[model samples]
Target: MNKLFAFFLAMLLPVVLFAQTPKMGEFTQNEIDLKEISYEPGASAVFLVASGESRFFSNILETNYFYRIKILTEAGKEYADIPIGYFAGSTNVEVVSAIKAQITTYTNGVPEVTTLGKESIFQVDLGNGYKEFRISFPNAQVGSILEFSFKKADKNIEFLDGWSFQRSVPVLFSNYQITMIPQLEYKMIGQGENFYHRSEKSEGNGVYSWTLRDLYSLKGEPYMKNYQDYVDKVEFQLSRYQTAATTSGPEWTDHLNTWEKLGDELIEYYSVRGFYRTNPLEREVLSLDLSKGSQKDKAEIAYYYIRDNFINEGEDLIYTKQTLPQLLKSKKGAPGELMLAYMGILKSQGIECNPVLIGSKGHGRSDIVPFPFLNQFDEILLLVKLDGNLQFLDLSDPLAPFGYVDLDKHVKGGLFLEKNASKLIPIDIRHNSNKLVFSNIKLDTETGDLVIENTIRNYFYEGLASAHLVEILEKNDKPLEELFSEKYDALEIRNVKVDDLLEDKNMYNISFESVLKNAMSEDLIIFNPLQISKFATNPFTQEFRVFPVDFEYAFNETYTANLVIPEGYELDDYPTNESITIPGSPIGFSYSTENLGEIFKITARLEVKNPLIPSSSYGDLKFFMESVSSKLTAPVILKRISIP
Candidate 1:
């Protein structure tokens, strides 16, 4: 029996040592094994194994990530090259190893491996305090295996590390292990509803691990905001710290324990008081005669002065390198810096104003959490107390008026940093956010054509949308009239007149004259009076939505078409009207027509009373948009009673 056991031990000793060997930062042969992978159905590539290990040693924390992917189809070739980004200020990322192997039937299914050298790796410096390390695997093709490992080390103890198990492609197995020294305390914030498989006991040693398997690819839908908001991920924030000699470390201050604390920290960081150290725009503010008018009126003059003179460069929540003097002279600054300048100018005029930090529409809403973090907010606006009433100003938006805050800036809540104390306050702006379009059409029996005059009035958010649309058209070098004609081939715009296009006002009006060709056919005249319909098809095409559909603000759009029927033609049939209303949701769509003798009137209204619709009511919103689309497609058929 002893001789038989000795023989088995000798055979397995080599395999056990190789498996248990410490390859913490190396790409091993097993990782690049190109054996057949039972990939998930419809998956272009599969992550055979993905693991991340984070260890805190001495003063620096190092995170090593390893990934092995098997390419199954042509679409998976994109996975052969990947870019990894890290904050350049604190972290240094290094590619430890990368290897690629291809298995073929040649020589009885032998595998040929190729190691990626340092020449295949490139480091790119992306402005805005970030850098990316791009790595490409050589000789990677279908049925090939690619494996790479990278390590990022940082001495900063901010505890901002986050891990995401899901990606654009399916992951077969993902495991993350974190080991920390008992000195650091962190708050684990998790998103998504997936639970990780973890060990029973590891808290005593300051070690934790999570494993996830068979995670499907994250599907993107229309109108979706930042993908990070919905991805299944876990993040850690350093709340406080402890040490061996002292119970709590000196660097572990409760600076962000409350919203007020967070506000105070930001005020100190941005030097809010320093912004008003000098009154650079005093001459301009004095010439406006703001003292005689109400505070609201005074704010309008100041808002327009900033909006017209300077251009916002789209950066948010941070100050620009240029000073106020430089910014005012150059007429250009980032959005946050512009708002800060506005506040400084307003404060010099004895106006009560404070800065408010909130997330913008494109940035998505802040997470509902107890603690306060600067990353939670994106944009900065001002809060003005006028005549004992609170007013918000989004001076960054050129078209937005003083009283009319940009709907995107209304993040429901903001940290209002006041003089003595700070608090979390709700942002509510009183402005009409609607759009009205009235079209009058007259059919010419002699020319077989129709002349339609469209009058469009946009208010608040609606005006912003109109301004953005025109800006995009101009940026792309496309004429507004030409784009309109292209969108509807039958319609040709003759003239267009716009109002308040160059002003900061609540409403803007546009009127245009267009002609529709072939309105009068040989025997029948077919025309779609609602030719200016914005929606051709439902925007919500996803079968299931896991995230809420955020419209940012409530808006109402009304379209009225007054058509004069051509002589000797009677209406054979009109499109059936549609009215859809969900009991709980605030979205509504209605279509109706009224026959007023010679002038046949058709009115369609799409009113969204609620700015946001939860995923639970996605079906209702989809159905409403679908109904409007169908009604817009069906034309009004006219039959000729007698040929003149």
Candidate 2:
């Protein structure tokens, strides 16, 4: 190996290096061998390479201790149950103890990693400029029998292989559910990119094609209000990636020092001598009291002003120097500028309006503390106080009518105030307007794995939300198909109940239950994970995930899921049904499970109680959320049915 390889390989060989691989576990490939990464469309490819098949095993180790490839096969290519290791290593699959964290990367948002287990590490000689290595995981805990499928498409591997790669496990996970099977990510592009991705399943199409977190174990326990304490713990561990200070944010002690020392450099904008006055249009909005003008007349007047006075522009132009005056003079503009100009006209006519600021999904979060991280604000909305109620207007998000926000723009925390102000305080508001409720479940089984299904309907938020997810899973929540093969062999899903049908608020409700056959025949089940997540079983789940959850008004929703047990199984225990009220708003959970019909009956009531939870109540609000989440994972055991 060269000096560069010798240097990095040596540096990264201690954590889980195991001799030939890098211990740091860089989540993605450090270098790309153009020749190795290639693909062909509509061509046949055997992605399920047989075990002990090639020299790739050793080369993979040399690169980092991790090597995984995703082949884009022609669509409709059929394959069999890939022979992944029954367990990860040389021995009978390591079982529960085998799949724990050995090493990890990441300390914050964007990505995270959780190593379930590691199998045999075999180093091999890759012919040509390539080398390889192989490591397997029994992966007995993955969704739906651990089927890592390769999508067959009419694309070529000639860097048909050319695709994005992340640093997480090699599995397919979409926006909501992880897609182990090839559900199709990129299809015929160009004409179809926009049209095809319109489905909810496709929202996370490309998102779930790979792993969620990188190999570096870089992700942290989900966000909690005690983010500082969590960050301290993460920084203490993980020798590879280290956590840094948050500058002037709440977590830091001497935030000002850290701010000036580590924050982004500010650019000075000095006024030039050529500054000119704004040439604004003389337009006025007359919101003739509904009592004053006919509904048709009011709508006609609004439509005319929108059509004749505003110059339509694209998303990019909306953020440029297209000031209100510029758009007003042209009597035309994009969403932001147009809204500003529109509000200006309305204000001129004394209609009264304000600009609402929100942080888009990927723009980080909007917690308006003293320090200003303008980058966090990625979206804007027009708010008008009419009859003491604020009307949400997102001219940028075209389909959001005039009273509601686009799904992506509807976040939990943001600032809304009269436009001409620098200081910001909390403002009371409502958004999305959909309510949500779910049930608690306890599955008593003879084995560790089984198929699970839950159906959902969209009523309030679902009807008003403009998201591909709400659209596809709109009529029905995605079909449930999670059954770990190694853990359990057979399973079934039944009673997919859904109601409250609608076309506009497209309201629907679904009720379903899961039946699992456990692998262990012991009189007692060790641990049953009703929901799968890294901390799905952790007791401190509540303390770790405290970010305000935005159900965004789903309309007083309610859900009841019941689990039917086998004849021999009986409920040994259940979480006591209890409800805790959060002050300032209606939000909490109520649940109970009892032995009924040779099966366990559990009804977990997850109610938003109300649409909006004030930030002042954030403390109790977070605690309540965690309490319910924790209750959801409360376990129950199945005793062997035997009598003298």
Candidate 3:
């Protein structure tokens, strides 16, 4: 009860209460000042151990919002000491000071980490004279807690509204989670601002925290402006690691000199480390008979091979180019490696195969720049020259029919990656050489409703549906559901069957039937949507998108829709029965409706006689689509029958 003791106890009480608010704490005794210093080269398992690690798993995404990343090793060395590469280009925006380190570790072990919880794994502002932040970690285990936010204060630039963060280096995680806190006070400026994780009070200066706990909704990242910038910056900054001189120039003058030197060094290093080998079998194991098989046939075979053996490595490295032989026989490979292997194998078989760079569905284009970032193209696939047309083959997609690459990876804007050279040029792979046959709809004048049936068969349709059927379903069901709703209000889809005729051929048969509530209604409620089958808005319409229109395989389609209308309603008008075909364009749209006693039978078809619409002729292709879309909307008018 003495005054001296009482004072000490009062001070202790405030200390306990202040710490209870969950202010972030330092895991290490020392911290690096961010303003004074920006990066750490390598990372220590011990350092991250103190910070914690995450091993979270997800079937849908390869990365997460938990944007915390660190380097684990240096060129062939156990990085016990954390180096600068471990923290290069890493910046953080502060979030809510927690009463406790909110951490979630996916697993535990010395080198194994998948957790994402704890304040130790994050960078925090360590009070100094100037603006500065610091973070330190020990040899971490999996499932470490992490929190990060984007801030204009931290970086010179303000937050971009549509900006999204992606992995600088591609990685396959067991799971991914990210907690992003928005500073509404600093409103992001741009289109799609409505998107970015915002709080309930969307239009204010509020600090709200959100986390990508599962990353279930994110599309696999394509190329990003900042992500590419980061990569370019990193590549440039780390020129000491790669051949920097190769950064510019049409072709490196004796460039392989550095590549060759590196190759020789790698050969020697691998020899010492027991990782080097020359496999004759690798060069010869897989062979493509491209010269002989029809493009469709080649597509079919590749589709089946990839679908069945798609080793779900997720974003993990399956087989590097150096390990092609092992991957060929193992029947497991990276998306790119597998694609190249198929090309090589086909080449061995006398197939005219080429490696084509794909920009994917999300972003990037095939535009050229002197110091262009290779990340512009995140996907690689094979293209075969058959007879004269070019075929886009995603050998990584087994479910994709011979003719189609899924829409995500189906961006047709690609350049070729050739050996000992980088001669970039546009590749035009399209939907042509195929046709569709339609059977029309008939209405019964007795009832106010009508029944219809249509069958869709693709001679060759390949893309997103075939390959990412699972991924699409796993990622977002709303888009698919919405697409169906938009197509038909009273539609019933059935017998959705996809087929592969042989190891090298593919086909699909879909029978859909629908009944409209007011086919005979006075208002033009009936929207006869000759449905186009793709998850994405065939964004390839003629006017907006200038890229070549890509159709999987040229195929013929036949649709039969027989409709029975109500007694009071009958087919009053039919689309001016007409059909048109354009020269050099593979697609044709045609439809006609007829009236008989109490029945209206209608038939229509849109066929692609070939794939690979050339860019030089993109305008014609767009016009063809605009015309088809226009004609498809022109419907047979259903007039109400007057009572006698």
Model 1 segments beyond 4 Å from truth? Answer: 1-49, 88-113, 122-131, 193-205, 209-220, 244-258, 269-273, 277-291, 322-331, 362-365, 471-478, 501-505, 542-546, 616-620
| Whole-model alpha-carbon lDDT for candidate 2 | 0.37
RMSD of each: 8.8, 21.4, 18.8
lDDT values of the candidates?
0.67, 0.37, 0.39
Order of candidates by lDDT, top first? 1, 3, 2
Q: Point out the worst 10-residue segment of candidate 2 by lDDT.
A: 230-239
Better of 2 and 3 by TM-score: 3
How many clashes would you count in candidate 1?
Answer: 0
**Which candidate number has the best TM-score?**
1
Q: Per-residue alpha-carbon lDDT of model 2 for 441-560, expressed as tens digits?
A: 454343444335555544544544424333455457553222122222233555644454543354545445555556344676533434422222333333322223344453443445
Worst 10 residues of 3 by lDDT: 232-241
Tens digits of lDDT, candidate 1, 313-414:
856765457665566667778888888777776776678888888866656234544466766677788888877777787766665655656566766677
TM-score sort, best first: 1, 3, 2
Candidate 1 vs candidate 3: which has greater TM-score? 1
Per-model tally of clashing residue pairs: 0, 82, 122
